[model samples]
Target chain A: MHNFEFVKPGTVADAVAALKGDEAQALGGGQTLLPTMKQRLAAPETLVALSGVDEMKGICKDDEGRLCIGGGTTHAAVAADGSYPALSAMASHIGDPAVRNRGTIGGSLANNDPAACYPSAVLASGATVTTNTREIAADDYFQGMFSTALEEGEIITEVKFPIPEKANYQKFVQPASRFALVGVFVAKFADGVRVAITGASEEGVFRWTEAEEALSANFSPAALDSLSVSGEGMISDLHGTGAYRAHLIKVMTGRAVSAAA
Target chain B: MELSDSRTIDAPREMVWQALLDKDVLKNAVPGCQEMSGSPEEGFEAVVVQKVGPVKATFKGAVTLEDMNEPESLTISGSGKGGAAGFAKGGAKVRLEDDNGQTVLHYDVEAKVGGKLAQLGSRIIDGFAKKMADQFFTNFQEALEGPAEQEPDAEVADGAETGEKKKGWFRRMVSS
Candidate 1:
């Protein structure tokens, strides 16, 4: 990687200010960005490190009773945090030990990798992505693969997940990367149910609305008996075919709902 | 990895063909294309910077148009080297079909990557490749379709958002 300036700000304002330059990029855990920089695929003139910001690194419940996780909180921390057991369990399985210790929920969410785990939980939980500038609903935050509603220079500050009645995340991990080949998250809310699938769609994480509807009426694995995931927009790669992923989506969703129940 | 996609552009087949052959159009449409030179007949040399997951590299390569049937179908094959990141070589068969006044552009691309990139995993590379193909077609369609009807400033905004997709798979092939 070419030489670049590094700045670690103690506050969000300072961090945001440091990223004002056109060539500046935010650094999060370096799990993804560092390797990218090492390969010289990304050559930012300035590296604004967000790790040093204290306000962006913890977990708690806000006025709305939603679990709010600071953007800088590492996956390891989330994995250990007892506030949300299912989310913590999901975080524990992200990547491996080193990755979990270094990678942050914000980074994973920001990168929006199709195979990433946090997106499924965030979407299923009906979370809110709070940025330095504004708040965005989870539904509107993720645009597509590696895409989000974040505007230029905006920094994600925290994610607020509404407590679900019952929730579970089941990931069919790709052996090599530990990233999901097809992961499913099912959350049963008082009003309805939400099922989100990751590592399957060409367009990235998406809701299994049909499954959601099925489970809303009858919250059980048997409720998903007649439902089928279409392979129309599923991703196909060396790991699995679109059809296989579609099939796994059904299997995983059933397992997740069963586990949650 | 192999990628195949088709897009329907709201333009004539001849116009689509001309746009495909135009260097400026290709340069603009290709994600991370820093420079492109030469012609369709002589083959074009290009420099592109691409990123996938965490790896990024600059690739210098050449592309030659083969099996040309003019305004109908043609094959484009090219290879590039990216020092330590790895290298990639591939070709795509592009076919243009006219449906009334519109043109349907179809492409079948087969590409291979070797080196650190290949070591990273096939799933990431495949995802990146598919995204690049999709972006290329989206850009091509937008170019042919002109600016959006309501957003008069959309064209300028769109141009500034170029290269968001990491491209240069062939370049990420070298040892750094």
Candidate 2:
């Protein structure tokens, strides 16, 4: 790894300021970043550690019933919270215990790995990503694989997820990594159903609109029987093919809806 | 792994074909090409810095156009080494179909990575390759269509000219 200076900031403003230095990178939990650094794939001149930012590390419920998660809040903390069962269950199953203790929702969303678990929940729950400078809707926040609306030096301070009436996330785990090979999060809101899928697309987390429409009219696993997702743009690797993943999306969505029911 | 995808561009087939041979267009279209020089005929050399998720590396590589059939179909193959990070080599078979005046571009891509990158996992490489191929074609199409006004988003950082450093590895690949 390249030699670099590291600084832990106490506040979001301080973290942002520290990241303005030459070739600086924000360190979140270091679950992904540290491993990458060790491989010498990512080398920053300065590392701005966000863990020390005390204000960004908790889970709370707002007056509007939205679950507000601090950016620094770890998977372990979120898993321990019983407020959002589906979200917490998803969090509990992320990687191993070590990763659960260190990986943060903000970091996971920031990295926006196509295979990660939080994005499916965030997108399905229609969460709002609060950055230091602006608030972005979950729909607008995720652009593509590892891409987000957050500008350079932008830090995700909080995520506000509107608790759904019923929600469940079903993940098909990739054996070695424990990352989702294909994960589906089904959320039933008062007005309609919102279905978001991850670990399946090259476009990152995306809404399975057809399923959402079907489930909105009739919320059940059978509602997805007529709907099928094309594997054309889905991610294909040694673990699974695009067609396999496309098939899993429906299977997982069915499983999620049943579990939610 | 083999992946197939297609894109439709607003420009004419001839224009799209011409742009494919243009070094400047490919340079601008290349995601992180910091420096690219050489003709399509003689093969081009480039220095690129890219961040795929968290893996950021300064890749020094070479691109060579192969199986030229003028405006119909061609293959673009490139191989790059990112020091200790690892090395990658890939190829894309691009075919063009002229729809009236518009060009419909179809591509088949395959990529492989080894060393630390491969060690990281198999899950990422295929998706990264597919994205890269699709991106290259998308960028290629956009280059021909319009919007030359804005700079390419991928080309960041202006490093000093890296002159004649590593030729041994590429020499073997190119020859072999």
Candidate 3:
């Protein structure tokens, strides 16, 4: 809506350098940033596009048993790659085909919307956010609703997630946009289980420790039956009540567990 | 959407209630609050940025305290607009009760959103509302719990990590 300058950088270093000013924003897929700008919610004087940054795109596995995903990888590539089922499924479900084809992981995490799928994935998988200056733990990376620990001008180079032993993501999508109304990502690691929920509760993206504890003892669907997701602090709106969403957490947790199993 | 949850704090009700009233403490605890300042008397003003799915909006508004019962119970309400992203308004009735030496907080919050947030993004609104509420209470818990943070041991948990939870890893790999 407002007049803004755009700069497509040739590399991650170039993009970071160009993002020095206060009103400068880094554009990845333009899935989130462009919409915000068009809505006039954000009026950055300059957009440092990372599309040309070669180092900021792709997928690879490290010898350390970790997978590193570049920030600029489109959702389409992810969803089409069956090797990464969870990421592909998540990307496939984001908005629609157009959005999936264009949305990038770096842009999504940098934006850090509480209900965004990537935040859930990162948090659930216990990933690391690798940026220009620092590598933030997944827990520290997400600060709060639409907020993150990233300093201004910091560009997320890649995110590292340990390949889970077995994992699955279950989301109850809103019909129109295919975004999670309430989604759950469940992983059973060696020490314990990790359960992450999105689109259901107000705490933003969070690990359901209680449910994880239940699953750690027993990784079956019935393990979550006795776990009561309290509605006391859950969000209530036109689509559903706090209790309703809380109910979905358990139900979806079961489905994700079963799917992963 | 409606979000309600309670957590038991190991402190007295009065102390917990007082903590709720402390603006500086609240500013730090409330999620996505870029800036929050004001008094319980004049009602506090805050700027909150929220993102759900593809929608992102920043809301600026004021919150007022009502139905105060000192260190026992109170009601807090606020309304804000996020321009084209949408507008939202809500209030919470919070109560603190003594549970032995601990205090248990009970809250009931009601909120409404208009514009694109209400129209195009209604499905996840409940989830978003619930998540925001959880962040509010959780932040309160953290503030009460103190910040002697624990370093999450990723190396220890790496082997156990597996499954479709690998999306972030794939994305990272793809980008690299």
Which stretches of candidate 2 lie above 4 Å from their native place? B4-15, B69-73, B95-106, B148-176
* Better structure of 1 and 3 per DockQ: 1
Between candidates 1 and 2, the TM-score winner: 2
Using lDDT, give the best candidate's number. Answer: 2
- Computed on C-alphas against the true complex, the DockQ of each candidate is 0.28, 0.56, 0.20
Q: How does chain A of every candidate compare to the true chain A by TM-score?
A: 0.98, 0.99, 0.96
Q: How much does candidate 3 score in TM-score?
A: 0.69
In order of appearance, the predictions have TM-scores of: 0.87, 0.88, 0.69
Positional deviation of A42 in candidate 1, in angstroms? 4.0
- The residue-level lDDT of candidate 1 at A22 comes to 78
After TM-score superposition, what is the CA distance of residue B5 in candidate 1 from its true location, in Å? 3.9
Mind giving the per-residue lDDT tens digits that candidate 3 earns over B89-172? Answer: 887889898999788999998878888777755645665666667667765655555422463212112234323223223223
CAPRI-wise, candidate 1 is: acceptable
lDDT of 3 at A57: 86
Among all windows of 10 consecutive residues in model 1 chain B, the one with the lowest summed lDDT is: B167-176
Candidate 3 Cα deviation (angstroms), residue A183: 1.0
Interface Cα RMSD, each model: 3.0, 1.4, 4.7
Top TM-score hit: 2
Ranking of models by lDDT: 2, 1, 3
Candidate 1's residue-wise lDDT over A146-173, tens digit each? 7777766688899999989899999998
